[model samples]
Target: MFRSLCTTALLVPLLIVSTTASANPEVDRMFAEQDANRDGVIDQAQARAEATRVFRALDVNRDDERVIAELDPQIASGSPGGDGFPPDIHVVLRQATMQLRDVDGDGRITRAELQQAFVDGLLKADHDGDGKITRAKLIRMHQGVVSPAR
Candidate 1:
């Protein structure tokens, strides 16, 4: 009887954990969206496409690329009068953009540059050192839960 009670106690927590994780509606929706082929895993192509869509959305100028200037509106919108965000935000974005793009430092953002930028940006946004960035993390960053690491 004691052994059975111990097993029940241990399994109860495990079951609760599994149930809680499975109950997250947002995760379920995201999984459905990302599982384009319904294969239950997001392959590289899907990840890349999702990243590309995000990059394009942030590329306010519709120039097919994101530059430091392109992020101004985003920063501004969050700040008073849309005046602009802290200089630090600009500096980080600028340096990150340059590091991702400007491989040649030629002052022009090319297609390759944009691709690299998206990859790098995705990595930066992925907090908790996890390989994947969940919707919660993205929302937290957007809400400034943590200043983005350049």
Candidate 2:
């Protein structure tokens, strides 16, 4: 009984510290940027803004449309970049994201299409259709609860 108590005491603090330290600062910064209003959630306006920003980044040639290559040059080339994701998972995710964004079968996603996708996706993630997405919703989306269909 004494040994069990001693072990639990040692492990409890370690577990608490691990949980507290597990948060990714980079992820927090990005999430904060998305939160905009700092309301602990992202609303439609913020989601649309993020979509526009992403479209601008993807439309490198400023063509107002995103080709497969523009989405991720490395993934399109079948040679993943140092984006930390395993090559297979990165390629699959990019493919799924492309499919979700590209409504037209023409193989390109236009700026408007991207924005619409964001709106639609946010609507789907909003569950209650309240026009707001909480961090829990975002976490669920990230965990593939909604999958690529989002």
Judging by lDDT against the true structure, name the best candidate. Answer: 2
* lDDT tens digits, residue span 1-150, model 2: 322222221221122223332334422543565688788887777767866766665556898887776655424333333333576876775677577768986889886776776666655546666778776665454343442332
In order of appearance, the predictions have TM-scores of: 0.42, 0.61
Q: Model 1, residue 103: what's the lDDT?
A: 71
lDDT of 1 by residue, 21-136 (tens): 33445345444544477765444455556445445555556776555455455444544554665889756745654554567776655555555544444444366665555555
For residue 14, give model 1's deviation from the true position in Å: 31
Off by over 4 Å in 1: 1-34, 75-85, 101-104, 108-150
Candidate with the greatest TM-score versus the true structure = 2
lDDT of 2 at 88: 84
Error of 1 at 77 (Å): 6.4
